[model samples]
Target: MQKNSFLTLSVAVLLVFSLQVSAQDAQPEAGVTPSSPFHIFDRFGDWARLNLLTFNQVRKAEIKAEIAEERLAELKAVVLEGASEDVVNQAESLSTAVAEEVETDVSRLDEEGRNIADLTDKFNQLSLRHQAVIEEILEKAPAESREALTKALEVSKRGLEKAGEVVLKQVEKGNLEKERAEKIAERTIEQLKKQVENRSEALKKITEELGEAPPELQERFNAKLQLLEKELVNVESNEQFKDLRERIREDLKATVEDAREFRKMHNVEDEDSDDILESISEDGAKVVERVEKILSKAKEKVAELERSVAQAQTNGKEIPARVSSLLDAAQKHLTEAVAAFEAKNFGRAYGQATSALQNAKNGNKFFEDEDSDEERDENVLEKIEEANKKIAEAERKVEEFKSKGGEVPAEALRVIEEAKKQVVLAKEALAKSDFALALRHAEFAKKVVEKIGALLERARKAVNSGTSNTLRVETKTEVKNEEVERPANTASSAARQPQVRQVKITAEGFLPRELEVKKGDTVVWTNATAKPSWPASAMLPTHDVYPEKGGCIASAFDACKGLAEGESFKVQFNPIGAWKYHD
Candidate 1:
């Protein structure tokens, strides 16, 4: 009996140990929380699962989308739980990894001649859900966790954009039925319209909360609201909706800037004041780094301009005195920026850097010889055609207005006459082979034609409302012939133009490991690998070995995010030197 008891006891001990090991290894379907000790094991489990599906690309893509959803859930959980910044960052990183994997898998599946219409549609819906969830999380997240959550939100946005692109490509390829594509486009437009409406409502609330803003602030808000109203009127196609979305995004950024100014002006303080201050401090450091990078690029541009001037002189072309003066001014500003940056005066450094960049751009304009190039001639011709089209459209709109019993304002008629005159001048300049002058006149004509259309649109609205018969045309100064005269560059300066260099990233690593490129040349890194890879400046994790700064991390040379298969990232090499980087 004692022997039997001993055997039973041993078995019991073995069972207990087995249970313990299983408990340690087991992970939830949605993955472990960031604070869990088994988090690493959960990640390892994900990797192992993905490896098992290597032969089934579609299945892999589906699994990846599910995994991305899990990561996104974890992100929301951490934010809602008021997790520490480190935990939030970890969650964000996890979400980013899975999202990138999904992106790469979709790309690979498409490249393999497989039908990915359904898969891309799935991803698109998933991304939209993720974006909504992230926006909700943003509202409730702690201030300290906002930055990480914001990054996670960006990842979701990128995923959404990529999936949308793929879906559109599938539609273009006729992989999806016409009805289904139309449905997809309609759904996308509806979603964007909802977002625009939400933003407008939020802005209205902000205005109400502020009670009384300065006249200029109120004017700015009104301008944005009016622009949004205009954008909302005619967005029927995917392309038009895309344009509207970008415009809304830009307006959102402007709104944020306006809010900051309002806060500073009123010395606003709230529960989040301390957090805002801390965030601003961090952003200030980034700003300083960005300014320093800008100065560095400005210096390189000035050097390039100098070389161009020397080349022009060598070719027996007269080097303009104003170009040299601008270059000198740029150099002086760069020096001042460097000193300000060293002194940790970020505001002054930013101003100096901006001035330096502007001066360099002005100097570089002297080297733009559009008249000497056939391609430029074509561009001018296109501009003239565009202007003529606008004038025709405006004339048609005026007739439509008059047919509706609306009277055209005298100013509107005058503007149309001026547009015709400008078009005539543009044609004359084109015949003379003065492409720059031709382009200038064409642009002015287009602008005048647009104004006339706007005037007619207002008049049509008034007539519809039975408010008035005459169009309201804003009084502005007309363009003069003398104001259009600008200096043109010689043909030799075109030789100094910047070129693009391609670098491929394969499974082995960056192809050609080392490369020689001139200052101002842009290098595009394309990923040909099966997996996602990040191309960053030397020193690994920190990525601070490069002289330039202001990337997502420590150096401007960094791609900042993983490039999926068939994806690409580009950066201009401004500071001439032997730079080291890795994937």
Candidate 2:
């Protein structure tokens, strides 16, 4: 009886131990359903999804490929247009390489399907190439060149939409699937293991860093964990899982931040810490697509404006003065802008040209408004023009007459007489208010007078024929023997003889025309005559001398400094005799 009781106790103990193990295996207490907040891990169930995680990389590569193709096309255009062969070839080679790289990226998707790092690196390199192509095209093409830009923009936008679609697909591929119902179960088991390990690690780290945890925090955490384990097999509420994830993540982040802050406060030296520069570049194709859309819109607007302006101009039956002026201004601005652009005064030129274009458009719009009376007095205009032309001709004739000597030929006088007769008749008509007849007669009369005067002047100048012989005079007390010996046949009509150094000199209308002298003789002269001794000219003999266009004497009046034209310039010669002098 004693042996049997002892065996029964051992067996019962073994059965209880087995039952506990079975229950533990049956429920992990952290099993999350698809509807649970921690259901994000459901997609990670498949071995293929877990291992082949290069979708991010693939998305990035697709963008790069799109950009590369865009560049290759641009390069091809340049090459076709007679660009440097080497550059074209280089572009081709690069395109080929990029193509291969893209192919390699796609090929390796099976091996590294969700690798974000590979995608990022490869995408970066490809993106650079893509950007290079776009920049090259943009740089070569003027900003106003819309066609190329439009096409490029369109390509970019399409690429972006496509890339977004690809990325969405990639994210979907990383999620829970219909075929993997057991994934949730496996994740729950893994999460439990992770939580235990993390808890142990945190406790150790907290102890080392903070020296100790407050008693209250430890007790509360322990209670929460116990309660969480009570509903092991079944999830009681969705918030429970959500709260658990949040509380754990938040606690960890806060702990790390607190430790760092504490170290700083205590002046602890932690050298391993660094300021990490994180660069998260978007996919190239997507960026291109967005930019292209903007560029395309701009292009369309510009085109529409151009077309509208052209149509407006074409529709104008007759351009108004104000509108024409505005157009002219616009053209000038455009021309200036083009010149500026050529000279590389890029900013100023662009502003001027754009302003000019806008002004032109405004002018065109104004011209489109029709409000002009297309009526004119054609006969009146003709008569007025004819009268004006006759008057102009008369003025020209008068000028010609003045240019010659004041004389009129007989033929010209007769012609003038006839014109006067006609003028008299016209005046009679004008008295009766016959404006057209009066104007016609007046024009004839004016022309006749002008022609007569011109003819008279020409005849006078022809008749005079004054001698061209230039004469210069020199005077001295000691006369030259050669001058005395000179033939007295100066002119048959008028002759002058030197009366043995006895010349009674007197200045009339002006002082003697002498600039310098040192004669050893005292002489006296008076204002003896009103007329000038020499025949200067018929037009202005006494008032002024030469044709100095703008009026003024280069030298001041000689009264203060020396003497005026009417005054005696006293120069008492001291010793030697100075002969030649000029005014």
What overall lDDT goes with each candidate model? 0.59, 0.37
* CA RMSD, predictions in order: 30.7, 45.0
Task: Summarize candidate 2's per-residue lDDT along 410-495 as a digit string, tens digits.
Answer: 34544544454555555454444334444555555554444544455545443343211111121222224444433222363134
Per-candidate TM equals: 0.35, 0.17
- Lowest lDDT sum, 10 consecutive residues, model 2, at 272-281
Model 1 lDDT tens row, 355-470: 67767876777677634456776888899899899989888888887785556754467567767767876777666555556787888778766777667776556433323222
Off by over 4 Å in 1: 1-31, 199-206, 211-583
Model 2, position 308, has a per-residue lDDT of 53
Best by TM-score: 1
Model 2: CA > 4 A from native: 1-132, 141-146, 175-583
